[model samples]
Target: MPSIRLLVLACVIPLALGFKELKHVSYTQLPTSISSAGAELFQGIEKGTADAAAYDWVNHVLYVVGRTSHLMHVIDLTDPANPVRLFIHQFTRGEGFPNDIDICGGEIAVALSANREVNEGHVRFYHTYTRGSGATDVVLDGYVTVGPYPKSIRYTDDCQSVIVANEGIPGKDEFNTFVNPEGSVTIIHNERTGNPAVQTVDFRKYNTDDAAAWPYRVPSKYIPIRPTVAEGTEPEDVVVSSDGRTAWVTLLENDAIAEISITAQGLGLVNNAVRLPRKDWASKKVDTSDQDGGTHRRMYAGLKSLRQPGKIARLRIDNKDFLITADQGGVTSFTNAKHGFTWTDATTGKSLAANIDNPELKANANDVGYLGRLQVSSLEGKLFDGKNAELVMFGGRGISIWDSKNFVSPMFDSEGSIEEYTDSFFHDIFNCDYIASTATTKSPDTNKDTTSYRQGDFVSGLDVADDNGTVYMVVGMYGTGSLILYEVDTSAKVPIPMFQNIVRTGGVEDTWSTLYTNKKLGDLHISDLGIITSDQSPVDRPLLWVVGAGSGSVSIYNITESLPVIPGR
Candidate 1:
């Protein structure tokens, strides 16, 4: 299999193509800062805002979503670097906030979260190609209802079904209380019009231990008392298995992932709850920040964080299944005295020892009152003893690989690699924190590493592509605003993924382009990544379509696939 995805490309090479690192080819920023294609359409737009994205290779069209703006901007990708926006459409619903969009088979679908206040969501379909009624672009089809706060929307590999990660985050009340709606994954079967079939898999049962962890949600003072809800798992994103029959959903708050099989009957009861591992600050070193008024380096024994994965991608190597995730672990900003002192709240009356007994109870003393704050006890089976443990912050800030089986076994991690890589080629200001082109920094802008490409940088999105014997991992760094490519060694029992090259999309001054309406496209927080296989792409090699939610821009890059990869992995 010499990169089966690209067949027609004639080539003669050695016995093996050992891609030690991903090759830096080229990239096209959506707006050249000088892009005046759609200046008349979107005027007064001056912020970094872009979120989920999907591509229609057949039409050479890219669909990017604006989560807060409730708009979907269409771009023609025939010209990779200088993409032209064909049109922009806003959601019809009064409160429709588009979360994710996917090119389902030939039909386009968009997931809409009506409003946080009203936990109602919907999935609307559209014909990829149509005509009449004086319309130049495609038209919307019918619509189907889904769960609340629907975040990640994806089509099964077969393209016959779709999965929506409905994160049931109950909007906070005036008093900062939450509703804690049951998180679920909605599967739309046979996406036909006559009878739309939808199944919502409630994750309450997977809580496993009845009393093991804190309730998914607790009541506020307004309630007579706090009631325990078993739905502790909140689904963030879903990635279908290699075969497309099984869907993997990430539980951000609970540090877990659920595997559910799809069939005509319904979503099989989740028999697998793979708990993510902890990024022990004890064993490994990480770059907390270069701006801590300290040396830019890795630290050890800092506290451990529940490897609460954000988005997950399923990968297959040598016929074995594996998973990768952007270890953007969720940590409460307002924790007990350890985080910071708070004299302005009611909970300040009690000390950690005198008042704190259950991790489910409010761990943050700022009595505006936060329920479901995680604690050390939850680490018993995963990390260590619950008593007197160190609480810390985490995000792995990179990527991690794990066996896709029920047991959580990590194979590798890219901690601090991206930050280290960015320091090598660009300015020092492009550290772990995202750099906006127009935004000046107070941190020392000197001392850049000029040798290594393997800088441990922060990643936001990932897309995978493979060839004969190599795996290519395309990573989007929200921190330094660059698209990174990597090669994974699939020969090992567990695949080993490593850094290769960094291609800045925009953001950095005088790097990707000189055109900066406000910020470079690199400054965009690359959120969604989708690959264009040779089957649909017109170019000589496959391509990648990436969108950043922050810059409200898109990047179309021609990719040479010879290695394995995945999006937001």
Candidate 2:
């Protein structure tokens, strides 16, 4: 509704107000001052950077999660002039690797990557604290294990419960090949000082292998034969409403999203004894027989199951009135009051026809869409845009958005086309182990055969600045030992990253990652490695902070002040 003004500053204010008075400075690349210092931080990381976490509760102590160290490296930012490593703690799990993470009320939860070799997955919780020596660290709190592998942990507003998306297998070897029951999602209720309350939710009632063929012809092998509920479904991401009363979990293995009721569980210190499910819970499962042949995991014959990039994603509320789902092919919006859930063309922005009894989301071929065009408005934030709610998602490949708004006939009808919409653009990429707003590393072409869909490095973690709606996405590119910064403006028409910075030690060409490169430019992607900053701030102007993960240092730059720092300066 309002226009964003980009302000640039000339003189640096006193160190105290420097972060506050700095104005937004636009640029194609990151500032040299910040980039140079960033690269130096990763000198000792052998395996490479895995994730990053920032503590704004106090000053700005940032924690870099790494695969090489297999530990969290803490950097103190009280001075902003110098960021020093405060602490490092290492730990390993059997089945899952550490991926995304979330921190609230002093507790931290990280998405555990599944190790197919072990067949177990889970999310680890910790009780974090600051030591008297000014070193910040975390003490491992009890963790909760779940189906196969949990890919992400999305926390409710109150941080009382966490919704985890279980991907079922470690992406390294087994990927989509494992034939277990569709992986299920779980809500872990965190008690203030005790272990978490875990609820295993199985919405895998529908299987893909039971579909019938037509026209006297056999079903094509290429068609996705849905796996059976007995085989498990994959749920990727869990999103919560602002009120923290509901959670929408996305099932990636099956094309569906589950609305779970959190209000029934209540907020604050949670009571662990509640079962919370009603009788209709059995009906929540959808039939995926058409997608998967009559037999689950049988279509692959002797080979392992390959993953098909499905066209379904959602942003909705649990046990609430609305849900918005977008498939790579189309978008679907459903209202709790009537019409069940309806499908739509994300590109064309029109509602499609659906038969709820035998629900097959039929979108006109002409209307098929991608993740870039869809968004959802909901009552799920500390701040609301009047009737225009939080646009829960900035479009991405195979991602979902969960908004708590009441569903109208056609989803987002009153919001107008996304092109005309004015909100800060948000760009999020999930790679490495964490989910970062920016893509950090470039995957090797040799590895493309196995990780074809993954063009870049992995994301280690992410966090949103509740005060200003700025999303801090951390991508840990293990291959190149770099961290990339991508910013999403909540008020932009489309997500456009204003800047990108690379974080690594020394020149990327001299790094060990370069020694293993098969082709040239493999290490060039991270030539400018380091920490990152964004312009979206509830504060007068926000200074994006970047701390080097490997070198154990920090870099701070006011996004507003560096716009005119001049190229090559």
Candidate 3:
């Protein structure tokens, strides 16, 4: 109303970048004695036996997969620590056993043979750069029946599409026990132009009430029963969502978590899903039959005991829309609340109240029976997506915090729990293998009441440290293999950190399954942490490259000192 009326001005922007500061400290012991200063290559020369669990760091070179020694080693970490092996490929089929390895562009995929006796080809692909040296050509392209094994494998950072976590069934068989159910996930849509288009998606077509058929039987050598497709849901791990469209498979027997949505007119089923029902899902089910009747006879089944499936991380809130999926044990977090993922319940830090059941929300089973396992600093979901958006979970018996805000129907609940760490016998295992280099974790008190956030243990292959968010988690203990460093709170809606240590050093036994780290070029490698990733690490770091499937040899280190002293996380 001021004469002429012409005045427009508006400004009000704050954004909110809080959370960042970490450095607790506890978990110690990463001294096979004390050696690795970083830098070594094919030391001994055997390169024969190696599990090499899971490692990936291309370009600068370093590709390994031994599964059972089907072999695949090519080291040359520019020099983050000194790894050298140039070449060594072997995959005559039958047990090449390579869990995970992806190298978009130059192409180099491997899931390898699988188990239960073996099934034709399983999954394999190579050409890392081809040429000569090894002559290359590990090809096989089409193969996957989904049985009692086929644990993990993921891609899509451009490497086309490859999500194989059949994980199959078998809670137990042989002579000790047997129940088996909930295990099936096959989403292979590879062919990012390279060729080999492979396409598949089957969890028994979605939900069959819980189908079965003698676990499918077939394989007395081939043809034990025939036309089958009815196995619970095992799905160990398979995440395809950096945008490549969509894919989050992870059933872990059956706690549940599927959100498929790729195009080309194919895999469009698996609609939205997120389960957490445990206590045996409810128990009661054990007909245990021989057949005769039909419906496969025998009935009653649903008791892998309470929660089991570990690892399943996916974050992308604030900006990337949203896409949470923590599923460590059964359901500490599960969100698609549109996009922003969700999870939290190490013990009960937060998020996860929808009704709270899955055995009280696990992780404190007396003190640490393993709630599940999680690792996701930021795949990009902004910072705490809707419906209470918030997550932070760690298992065996401690760590929990969920809030999830409430995206569309989001409501995880919880808010603060940390079972102290019940005695610490390792809690029950289930550390999910480990992966987290600092989402955020630091604060002696910093200020404001102190919300709490910190995590560690990306171990799988080891190699992370740009500024020292801190996380090295690769421990094969007893057998001797260490690398533990926590200090998180990089920014935290859930960074992870109760307190941890151990810090750098060599290993023994084989050092737990496989471990990998190439966050551009920091570098680290180990195996036996879960069982295999063989170890042909490559990183263009301070100079890091390793290869020792089992003493085959390859070493090099030169860090001297970085973080709290930098040992293990």
Q: Which candidate has the highest TM-score of all?
A: 1
lDDT digits (tens) for residues 454-528 of candidate 2: 212222222223224543322323323333333433343322222233333223223224422321222222211
Off by over 4 Å in 2: 1-48, 52-56, 92-96, 113-118, 131-137, 170-181, 193-195, 208-226, 229-232, 250-258, 266-541, 545-557, 561-569
List, residue by residue over 240-281, the lDDT tens digit for candidate 3: 667656776655434445666776533545555455432221
lDDT for model 2: 0.35
Measured over all alpha carbons after superposition, the RMSD of each candidate to the real structure, in angstroms, is: 9.0, 15.7, 23.6
In TM-score terms, candidate 1 sits at 0.75
Query: Compared with the true structure, what per-residue lDDT tens digits does model 1 show for residues 106-144?
Result: 789888886553366898888764222334566777788
TM-score of each: 0.75, 0.48, 0.29
Whole-model lDDT, model 3: 0.34
lDDT accuracy of residue 379 in candidate 3: 15
lDDT-wise, the better of 2 and 3 is 2
